[model samples]
Target: MTRSESPDLSVRQRLHPSSPFFNAARHLKKLILPAIVVFLVAQAASWERWLFLFVVPSILYEIYRFFTVRFHFATGEMVVRDGWLFNNERHIPFERIQNIDFTQTLLQRWCGVAEVRLQTASGQEPEAVLRVLAVPVVEEMRRRVFEFGEQAGAEVPPDLTTGWESREREFEVEDDGSPSPAPVSDRLLLHLPPAALMKLGLIKNRGLGLVLAGMGLAWEFDLWERFDFVEKVRPWFSDATWQRIVLLVAGTVLAGFACLLLFSLVWTFFRLYDFRLTRHGDDFRLQCGMTTRLSATVPLHRIQFVSVQETVLHRAMGAVSLQVETAGGKSEGEENASMSRRWFAPLVTPGQLTDLVAEIRPGLSLEGLDWQGLDAVGRRRLRRRALFLALLLSAGLALLFRPWGGLAIAILVPYALLHSAREGMFLAFSHFAGGIAYRSGAFTRRTSVTFHDKSQVISLHESPFDRRYAMASLHVDTAGAGTAGHRIQIPYLSRGVAKSLGEELATQAEQAAFRWS
Candidate 1:
């Protein structure tokens, strides 16, 4: 279908009769059945059965209202009409849609239905959704909306601003009306690479071990019982000598925890095996599951950041988790020690990851990210700051843990020195036509690249110590995540370079146009 050629077309021009009223009613059957069951159960439990009289009319009226509502889906716009007595309608013009998301829930899967959500430009409730359509119908609707959105130059707002739609058309009937470009053949995209799969299973999460441990422990003992201090100690030590026994037991417990960390590390490795990543055009797909498989696709433009991470163990093994962040929601703040999203390779050979990054963003030349003379002043500043932090940590530990804490604090000295030096020596920045990229990390190195025109904001930061070092940090923010969030920060960079880069990016950001498609 094509968009209306006439410039004078109004919002109503795009309206079309919805599939069928029965389609909505039939699809809503599952939801309605549960509500009816709850209502009947409550009525049966009522004191005098009088409550049934009130509930029956209310439920019937609601059901009737929903059944009678008329919904419209068109290439250029979408409108829903509903009312019992006073009619009400909601509309979203094609040009105003910032995003169009199609999702399929488990229930929708059984019903062969999909949900289409539309986001608008107002920054408020950007879009509304119409759910429960047949898969084929949903695909057609998505294709048409996207085509129109492209024509209108409508901006598709990100669902989560991780950075990442259009109207209907009218055309002569073809022999068969089918959604253009059939869904990518599942067979073409479904190969299971053994190596990728192995990596995925080994590194997915440590919870697998925790679950096995919990189940084994539960099966072996009466886990529900809480041990009293004396009852617990009596098995190993006489109650009269419990104090001495308590000290010895504490030492063993500490040792056991240390050993568990080591074991957990090993267990985590073997579990995440056979990880694989494949690309189908703009869509990057990942499938890796041990007992049950997980399949996910991320559109290229939807990716907000690409992160490479290595733990202390990963560093020793020359391995890293290549993570790509998309417009998915913000982290729930839980401790997910492993990669959040799909990884390219959990056991990446050193130097190969840079090649992977270049492959992901072909336009950016990561290999050209020069660190040769990126201001030695900043490096000295970082070293001095590290020394000061080490001293402060030592003092704090001494105060908090007294004698024992003081010994713990001593550990910070080597860590601080090593991290500080690594941070200074490894840091690099590259300015390209598409974006500005920064790379730095000690244990788990990360390189974050933000396009100037695509960036929403540029911020500069400096601490008291940075002032002495004549150094500054620069951050670039994008739309969606808002201020202070989803920022790209370069720590301890030359003041001149930071200011110049920030100003350049800020200017481009101001000039770029905003879209809601």
Candidate 2:
């Protein structure tokens, strides 16, 4: 049979529908806050008799939305139609499509459905989402969307439907699935084990966040006055037993820290459960999460930069985290925090990191490069800046708190010297075959690799201090590197070196292939 004669062809042409229950749940989720407000207003105003006016309309609207929502492909574009009163429609062309991500909540997995998000280079939220579709349908859509090489008259494989049905049967056969053979082209890159995930949690700086959250909650509930720990403990301890008091305070602090660490471990386990990275064709796919499963696809050519991050703890353990910057930036704030901008390989050894980078970008290597350090003048400038800032901070503190704050100068001076030394030791830069790498940070070292050709702008910057020292900084900008604007910053280089490097990068960028989409 020709492609049009195949049953799968009919499926492809047909307008795909979303799950009714999924629509209901989504509508309910949206109305929850409004419903609460309405309930409260009705109670206060003694308008309980009119509650049905709100409830009935909401239910009816959700039912209408469930039936009206539909999507179909037409004329090389995907058309999505939804909304009741508004009648919203979005037509997205195939070429505008950048990435297609799939996600499944625990409930959706149980129902054998998934949510597909279509991302474009618009730097906004997803262009479109197939909210709820059967697993087979989702897979088929993905194949059709990504496999642009297939001809318009191309026939669907005869076994395509059968293969999907077989997969479904296997899923139904067991709680997880039958042990199946791996795909021919798919290669596993890295899988974070339970121990490694735990380490990631331990190394993460969650203590400050937790402390801030606790303080906010205490203030909100006015709990500080109700059970003040210092007040309560002070009454129980004898003023004369100074050593005992010191020991008690230290024990309490240790216990609190232990609790925070335990919380971090549990949080990390759930956040990054069963993390796995795999490569297929020109794309790298990452799958992770516990309650909510996330699948993100990153095309090799679209990756603007790759970063290898190592906190002090991670370095001590010989481990690092890998992240990549793609063309489209994620939305701002915590709402989109879980979105796909930061695809993480939680904990990988240094050797494994090198292998992973090479796998993602064949010519790119993370090791054995000759790194260049800052000049002596630049190092001295940094030290001077650190000392100046420390003195300013000490002065402000002393003015605010008198005697106790004056002691801060003693602590700040040494801390500033140590920090400056660490920065000088840590900062370095190097040029690779197709890209340049900038390494920075003291406690948490970060190495960012960006292609010279993909750079949107290359410029040399010099402050008054840098000018006096005959030094300059080179900045390279790219679209995907988030709010920082500059993707690569090689600070503290000689003026001549900076100018030459900038010119070289500009020339390379002009000659390199530019493909954002």
Candidate 3:
């Protein structure tokens, strides 16, 4: 049934054939308990009979809303007409729709329906949310919406050169429901060797610290406890000489350290056990979830950029963490949007990481990888700047503390210089080939890769210090992931490279303006 011939005249236009009041009343029953309690309280705490007049009007206003609200969804726009005495209508074009999120609460699940939220770039209260139909209907609506978008030049067809048609057609079924399929490749994108898995487990996760602390608390409650090795050994050396006592103490300390290392190893392995990644057509499939099963198929081109991060410890261990950025992929609030979810590789060899990237993105190729090696001149300059800054900071600290000033300054300089030099070397180490690679760290080292297509906005700037160094920082913004926005800061690059790269990125984006699905 088409929308034009519908007899639901009260609704000038409707996305679906149901009345908004029908949906609202179905949901309004949920408020009955609270509403009844409020009414009883109002009756008992009444100051005057006039107060009852206000309550009566408030009740009528809610009742009026129960029957008056109307919403409509068209191919190109979604419109909502609401309110009582004052009427307001909101129309959102499909092109402006950032995402269509469908959520089913426990109650909504029982009723076999879900809520469809239309989020756009426009900042508004309540957003454009609608109570909608079943999951299949939502999927169908999404597909139809995409078809409508194609008409308005909002989406580009996938490149046929990539053999996407055969892959896409595999999932296709005609209106009559005949089978159309393609051969599934058994080739894997990643294979985790047992040694790699063991190394991955030894890495520290911020969450693991909390988990271990919780376990220790539980041990105090008799849920578990460490073996009392010290108590057992003390009796054995109760009457021993001073030399024997010292030897026993040293052995106990060594044993305790071993136990701690063993525990950490066990914890890491279990968290990352049997980790695997596979590619199915243009989608990257990740199947992992320890307590809860998780399976997500991320569209390849949808990835905004890729980030490889490491800490001081990780760098020494020869491992880097990789994060794939995408738009509107987070399920949490704005604060956690920048973080990774269901995507982590505790330890991967550099060669393995390169292979993974090549498999996932054909255009992402890093050739002549030797630029990651810093020259002697660059290293010396970095160390010098670090040492000079450290001395200046120590002098400032000496001025603040007088009595122990010498001792304080003595300890601060070396510590700061070492930390600064390490960080300086980390940032200066970068390589660019298929795309641009910039590795950065002070505490946590990270290498971010920005592809030609994914680079949306590129800007350059030079501080006074940068001007003296004959360098500038290039800021590259992509389409997805992170809280603030898609950005990568590459510092100390030549001014020419920064400006030229920015111009090239802008041109590529313009050429591929409508290339997203």
Candidate 4:
């Protein structure tokens, strides 16, 4: 039904009774460490005892918050009101809502509750968050917000009921007959198998660096002495023989590596447990996570670009990852930069990648596209640049270490030359029916596809180095472009070619319809 014809949403609703406990738990979790420190200080010094007095009131305040918070559906907007001392209210229009995500932790799942987050294009934080609601209530809210576009300007559907009676009747048989199962619009596009997850764990060792940094900090703080770790290892050093020292160092390194490997495996598995990508009409839905379940949706129209990425090991295994860039912004306090943009496929074979892409974006194909390489002049410029950088590095090393560093140039020069040659050969770009693709990267290959319709800006750039060589770069900008500031970059192109390409991209962007929802 159209929004105008839909019933008014002035009927207020309150969260489940368990919400107060969950809110208190979250607050306690954040303050636990500080509380422990304060308690220890209080025990040692009487003056610090007053700090513990705040804990009881904090818990009571959270319980009070539950009574004040209220939400309701109002015309074309969702209204939320809360706060006892400092009154606050928020009105979020259905049209401005970009994504509605639901997340539930293990405890919440057991309690049959979920947290619903409403995201807008503001790029600051979620417009509204309904924390600790019944599972059925969460589902009803998501259905209304996400499906609002399809039913806009139409009468509300008869089955779109949020009343308690309707929710109870959902699982009961109808009087006429057992109703057929609701038509399933969401189709599974990809699922990461256990074997693929293991492979990903092995190839992506992101946490190892963090572990090493932690060890360094521990050593700096004299943790080894406090923990008697140095005393345990001193026996081996007492021998002071080359063989003993070598074996001791090697064993320690291998043990640390093994621990890191196991940590990565378990961490990856838990983070991506039961990963599933599904296509729901013109939108995409991603559901995953073990301890904390997360469900996110991406409208097809909001996708600005698609990236097919492969690491050195991933390429060798014939597997790739698919990520889409959307106009959605990151939620507040989200530390993982990559988490804001959901992955379409974390691990997929080439064949699976092709099928998944085709299903999501019809008429776009990555296979058999005609690729054009950089001109000889551009290639020469890249090689020269690489060589100059290598020379500078070699000079610095020689100045710092004298004779020993002088020998390092023998290794660096040839390695630099080989890298330059490889980059020159691999740098290329191609145009497809729907979008333009740029292929680059020496060791880890990445191909980014940006649709003409989503293109926001096209420009030509030149630095002093490029000016000397009469070379320029063409860049295409779109919504949600990464730190690189461009979705597609073809560097070291001739001045004329760069300008022509920029003009063509600008024309296409202007002529194409703008549908960035």
* Candidate 2 lDDT by residue in tens digits, 262-360: 889987788678777876566666777787777776666667778888888988888888877666636755434324455547689988888988886
3 or 4, which is superior by lDDT?
4
Judging by lDDT against the true structure, name the best candidate.
4
Candidate 1 matches the true fold with a TM-score of 0.58
Ordering by lDDT: 4, 2, 3, 1
Candidate order by TM-score, decreasing, is 4, 2, 1, 3
List model 1 lDDT by residue over 191-217, tens digit each.
324554444334444545665765565
**lDDT, candidates in the order shown:** 0.52, 0.70, 0.54, 0.73
Off-target runs (Cα >4 Å) in candidate 2 are: 1-68, 75-77, 83-88, 93-95, 149-183, 205-208, 220-248, 338-340, 483-486
lDDT of 4: 0.73
Off by over 4 Å in 4: 1-7, 15-17, 20-69, 82-88, 152-180, 216-232, 330-340, 394-411, 483-486
**Residue range with the least summed lDDT across 10 consecutive positions in model 3:** 158-167
- TM-score per candidate, chains pooled: 0.58, 0.80, 0.54, 0.82
RMSD of 4: 5.5
Candidate 2 residue 408 C-alpha distance from true site, Å: 1.5
User: Candidate 1: lDDT over CA atoms?
Assistant: 0.52
Candidate 3 lDDT over residue span 1-517, tens digit each: 1235232222342333332433555445545543544454445545533443444454554456545556655646656677767777676666665544444444554555555665443443224555545544555445444445545543444222112222235446454377544334423566456576656555653345655755665554333323355576668788999898888789887886666666766655553444556554454545432332222334555565677766666778787666776555344454223222225344566776777677656645443344444445445656677677767776776677865564665776677667666767667433353455666666776666766566666778898977876777777776654532224776666777667766766676567553333
- Scored by lDDT, model 3 comes in at 0.54
